[model samples]
Every structure is written in C-alpha cells, then in structure tokens.
Target: MSKWKRLQENSLLLLPSVVLTLALGIYPLLWVLRYMFYDYAGYGNELFIGLDNFRRLMKDTQFWDSVGNTFVFAGGKLLLTIPLSLILAVILNGRLRGRGWLRAIYFMPTVISTAVISVVFYIIFNSYNGMVNQLLLKYHVINAPIDWMGQEHAMLTVILVAVWGAVGNYMLLFLAGLQSIPNDLYESASIDGANATQKFWSITIPMLGPVMQMIVMLAIIASLKGYESIMVMTEGGPIGRTEVMYLYLYKLLFPVSTGSAVDQQIGYGSAVGFATAVIVGIITALYYYLSKKMNKVF
Candidate 1:
C-alpha cells in the first residue's frame, strides 16, 4: 500500500475513539459551562443572568456547608488512604506465601460497584441494628449503640467508607511501583549500613515518586467527585450534615419540594456547581505543582 493510503487508513481507524471522547466527555463539559450562566430549570427557556448565579452562590449558606464537607471528606480520605495503601503495597511486595491471593483480596474492593458498597455500608453502619454497633456492644466498647449514620457522625462514616473502597486500587498501583524499583538500590543501601527504615526512606520512596503522584491525583479527583456513594448511603443525611458539593448540586437540580424556601434555589445550585468546578480545578493545579516539586526533591 502507498504511504499516503496507509496514513489515511490509520487516521480513519482513530476517528471513532476521538469522536466518542468528544461526544461523551468534551460535550458534557461544554454543556455544563453553558448552563452555569443561565437560569433554566433543565426545561424552560434559558435566560442568561451573567454573574447573578455566582453572586447568589456567595451568600448561600448551604453551598458553603457543602464546600466544607467536600474538603473534610477529601482531606480525611487522602490522609488515611494513601499511607495505608503504601503500607499494604510494601507488605504485599515482599516474598510471602499467598502473596498473589492477598493482593487479589486487597484489589477486589476496587472492582465492586460503588453503589453496591454504599448500600452494604449503609446497613453495616445502621444506628441500632447495624453490625458495627452490635460488635461494639458485644465487645463492651460502648454501653449503647452509637448513631453511626446520624447528623454528628454521618459525614465521618461516609468518609471512612470512601477510603475503604478506594485504598485497594492505590495499593495495587503502589505495588506495581514497588516492583519496578531496582533490587540493586536496596542492596547498595544495605551494604552502606542502612537499616530497613533508612533504605525505605532513601530508595523505595524516591523511586515511587511518579506512581505516588498519579495515585494522589486520582484519589483527589475521586474524593472531590464523590456523589453516588453518598447519595445511596445517606441521601445527604438526616439533615444536610453529610451533603458534599455534588450531592448539594443534585438537591438543587432535583429539589424535593418539601415546601421549604431553600428547596427552590435552582439558580443558586448552578452557582454552587460552578464554584465546585473552580475549586476542583484549583486543587488539581496545585497538586500538579506540588507533584512536580516533589519529583525534584526525590
């Protein structure tokens, strides 16, 4: 075949993937941007209101509450999940019996649907009849069952569930990274009288920089976008206590119409959505910058 014909054929082969990505990914983002400036109920005529939506967002108490919840949820998950995954990856990387089985067990949770995990955890954390309370009670840890899904602890419970479901995927990623490191690095460190802790600090961590960056980026994005699990588990709560940004946006978009004044704030919800996009974008950029800095330091 002629070179020109081959190039043309390759281009044709790439067309479907490019078209699908644009249709599914790029188009929706563009649609959301358009909707951000308009006062539309997802049905009627869209009236462009310029910065009015944003203005309303600035004064909206619920929007701020959701923002605070999003931060807490994301921070809690990142703090616990990353370190735990790294530890599990390190253990699993060693030559131990049933290593493969253990790795599979750790990674199995990631493959389960988030919706299913949410439902299961909801039952597990139930205030009175839940497994967690029953276990605590049986063990004499608490005299009475704590309200795991109540206003005070609901957000914490959701954050814990998210971290549990997420750690497995990052563990696998870290394991792959650990395996990629040259054995000679460890050998040299040991020869230089380095202890296990020193060797890990000097060798394992530096080499795993890129993998850690990717894992953190993925985790942050997932935490920021947390919705389905929260929706299925708490439905934004016994109150708005567990309402993260995405769920708050959902409530705004699909108001329950319980005759509450705040329930009709669709414009305000769109504003919150736009604010969330901005916050997430800033965080992603900051993470990229920090990752680059860490890459240099390592």
Candidate 2:
C-alpha cells in the first residue's frame, strides 16, 4: 500500500479512541473549568462570579479539615499496606504448598466491589450489635462493646479496612517484580555468606528499585483519591471525622443530607475538585522529582 493510504488506515483506527477521549474526558474537564467561576447548580443559568468560589473555599474550615483527614488516611493506609504487601509477597513467592490458593484468598477482595466490601465491613464493625463487638464480648475480651464506627475510632476502622482491601494488589505487583529477578543473584549472595535479611536489603531492594518507585507512585495516587469505601461506611460522618477531599466534594455537588452546609453547588464543587486535583498533582510531581534524584544517586 502507498504511505498515504497506510496513514489514512492508521487514522481510522485511532478515530474511536480520539472521539471517546474528547467526549468523556476532555469535554467534562473543559466544562468544569468554565463553570468553576460561575454560580450554578446542575440547572439554572450559570452566573459568572469570578473568584468568589475559590475565596469561599479558602475560608471553608470543614473542607480544609477534610483535606487534613485525607492526608492522615492516606499516610496511615500506605504505611501499613506497603510493608505488609511486600512481606506477604516475599513469603508467598517461596516454594510453599497451597501458595496459589493463598494468593487467591488475598487477591479476592481486590476484585470485589468496593461498595460491597464497605457494606460488609460496616455490618462487621457496627457499634451496637456488630459482629466484631459481639465476638469480643462473647470471648470476654472486653467488658463493654467498643464502638468501632464512633467518632474516636471511625478513622482507624476505615484505615484498617483500606489496608485489607489494598494489600493484595500491591502484593501482586511486588510478586511480579520478585519473579523477574534472576535466581543467580540470590545463589551468589548465599555463596558470599549473605543471610536472608542482608540479601533482601542489599540485592533484592536495589534490583526492585524501579518497580518499587512505580508501585509507590500508584499507591500514593490511589490512596489520595480513594473515598468511596469511606463514604459507604461512614458517609464522612460522626461529625465528618472520616471525610476526605473527594467525599467533601461529593457532598457539595450532591448533598445527601438536608442539614448539609453547602447545598448542591456545582460551581463550588468544581473549585474544590480543581483544588483536589492540584493537591494530588503537586504530591505526584514531588515524588517524581525525588525518585529521579534517588535514581541518579543509586
């Protein structure tokens, strides 16, 4: 075929993806950008109010608190999830019996619906008559039923659930990285009298650097953006104790409660959404910079 014909065929192949991107991704983004400056709900004429939305956002303590809560939730989830995932990956990668079944058991939650998982957890952790408190009470572990979903424990409960749901995914990623590594390196390290701990730190870690960096970057983004489970479990409730940035934005755009402070403000929601994106972008950029520097050093 002629070069022009070949080019035309390639363009035809690419047309669907290009159209879908414009329709689903680029157009909504442009709409948000335009409406962020205007006062409008999903209906009504959009009134351009300039920077008022952003100014209100700056002074919104509840929104800022949700931002803080997001960092806390993400930090806690990453700290517990990443190390545990790596440990599980290392253990299950060995020549152990039933390792395939074990991997499936851990990975099953990842494939399950987030809303379903959250509902299950909510039932398990219900304060008054939940499975957790019932079991503890029956076993004489506690004299009284502890409220897992209460103000004092809501954040911790959600963090634990997040860790459980996330560990398997990162574990599989780490396992892939582990399998790619040649056995010769481990054999050489053994001959050199390097113990498991020493080898893990010196050889395995260094070899897995690129994969680790990518995994961490992905984990950071996912953790920051995650709020659905929290919403289903807590509805950012117990006085917004578990409210994260996206959850807060959801409320503004679709206020579920009649007493919610901000009612269905699409314009304000857009501003908050923009701010959330910027926050995520900044953290991702910072991680990228540090990873590049670390790559240079090692």
The local distance difference test score of each candidate is: 0.86, 0.94
lDDT of 1 by residue, 1-298 (tens): 9999999999999999999999998997777777778887766677889888887778878788888888998899899999999999999899889999998998998999999999999999988899999999999999999998888888889889998898899999999899999999898888889999998888898899888889999899989988878898888776778788988887777766322344444555656777888899999999999888866875
Per-residue accuracy of model 2 over 175-199 as CA lDDT, tens digit each: 9999999999999999999999999
Number of the top TM-score candidate: 2
Top lDDT model = 2
User: How many times do residue backbones clash in model 1?
Assistant: 0
Candidate 1 vs. true structure, TM-score: 0.91
- Which 10-residue window in model 2 sums to the lowest lDDT? 254-263
Query: For every model in order, what is the number of clashing pairs?
Result: 0, 0
Off by over 4 Å in 2: 257-261
